[model samples]
Target: MRELSFHGVTVRFGAGRSALAAVDGVDLTVPAGSVVGLVGESGSGKSTLAKAAVGLVPTTDGEIRLDGAPLRARRDRRRLQMVFQDPYASLDPRMTIGASIAEAVPGRPGRTGRAAEVARLLELVDLDPSRAGSLPSGLSGGQRQRVALARALAAEPDVVLADEITSALDVSVQGSVLNLVRDLRRQLGLTMLFISHNLAVVRYVSDVIAVMYLGRIVEAGPAAEVLTSPRHPYTRTLLDAAPRFGVALDDPVPADSELLDDEPPSPHDPPPGCRFHRRCPIGPLTVPERTVCVEKDPQPAAADRPHRAACHFASDAAPASLEVPAR
Candidate 1:
């Protein structure tokens, strides 16, 4: 496994003043043989960041490095593979499962060798090797996802970018796919960036967690620490919104609590200073005296810090002052 690092990476669409910053100047690292879960809302740039790493999207500035070396060429990029969310769309309906896996294998392994390799990959993913001849249309949703994972592994990639790989599956199937992810990481020592909107799923498969809001990673740290004691207001809100087993959907929300229902500011013309201030529960919108969040952007914590939050009030008593009502 290889370490993947992004340094001040910025991805912008359009040109000049009309450009939309899908991924702002962000710095993150996926340590070798470890899983770093990237969690956020739908338009928070989690998917965009994954696409940028695999060269599916263009980055305006900064660098992407694998094992500390810059990825400037196409072949170098092949080592960083991605497993997209939709398994049905990712695979070809006409191709057999074995044929799909074989397409990603490097070099000319010849006919017999290729078949053996394909069968091995099928078995690796807990699918019957005999079903290699079956088309994607014949498999279940979870099985197709396993095939997608098998195809990514066929490339022998150093780092895998899994972009919401479980969102489309049924609740029961979601657990199987998630278990496969954990098993793959342990058995293959895979280094991965797992992106998801579900904090519960992320907490299950992640070693570290990074929470993104409107393209910037607002908080990141060890999974246990980030989930149990989140430093950022956005992170706390996400944890609160996550569905608990006993909690009913119709449970009344506190009148004093500010929900995340407010739409985020447009990325095309992001507001000055902290972008989250408009929707921040404890920001200037709630506390009239805290104008700093509206006037100046809060710098992220130093890279060396174990647990970091990009909020000026993270270390202060702000979180204590405005308690988010418990579910």
Candidate 2:
């Protein structure tokens, strides 16, 4: 089932700083009943892609289609739900958890039979119905996030776009929430676009992976292949950062937060040639990879199969940076 597809999607704030021109030409397809993980740093455009997928943000260029229908084509909105990182903010401080969920359901008047529906939704997310009466302020971080999940499901959606959904939950509860989502996806066969900066988290839940940089996908492939033998330079760096991701970046000596290049360029006004030329670590690689990489742009089909990368040298480039330990 073609749940979602983006053809040559590009997002530019305007024409000046080159932020997303790096991703000028991108094609994304989310097959039905599969989890596609979109991974990148804070400004890598991962979240922007997520927001666009669910119609939370508009795309500056290109087209986004859901179930082969244009996403902008008056979607029911509830059909494709989003689970935000801040669970508390997604919920209302004044409204009860039960009412919050009921609002997502169509044509539901008042709280009639809402108690049972709330209970069922809570159970769906491994929460207790008794807690439905409680406000988001009364719930723990994990519980609040769980409530967020339940609320997303309240819409009875066939597809879910989870943007850093578990970032705020306790490590202990992270597994359970991920498990719940996995279980639901398996049982309900829901299609999901799981956006996250955590490589491990993305690896744990995704069937396939799409690594983003600037505003384009640098590498994409089966999760196992991409994680085990990453190809792109950005992919390796991100993996290297993963081992120490838990460390407060501010406290880290050099700080992983350092811009790979400079200013990340402006999404509005990008540079000439490869948008990543300024930051691409591999000095100058092979023909297609390097020639266009820094001065031009790269197509995402450099790899042999599922492991497609945008770098010109990505095909022959060895994994020099991130090497997982032998377990």
In candidate 2, what are the lDDT values of residues 70-110, reduced to their tens digit? 76654545578889999999999999998898877766655
The segments of candidate 2 whose C-alpha lies over 4 angstroms from its true place after superposition are 15-23, 109-112, 244-271, 285-292, 300-306, 318-327
Shift of residue 2 alpha carbon in model 1, Å: 0.6
Worst 10 residues of 1 by lDDT: 317-326
TM-score for candidate 2, please give it. Answer: 0.83
Model 2 lDDT, residue 31, Cα = 83
Backbone Cα, N, C clashes tallied per candidate = 0, 16
Error of 2 at 306 (Å): 5.9
Which pairs in model 1 have colliding backbones?
none
TM-score of every model versus the real structure: 0.93, 0.83
lDDT of 1 by residue, 147-232 (tens): 99999999999999999999999999999999999999999999999999999999999999999988988888899888777777
Q: What is the C-alpha lDDT of each candidate?
A: 0.87, 0.74
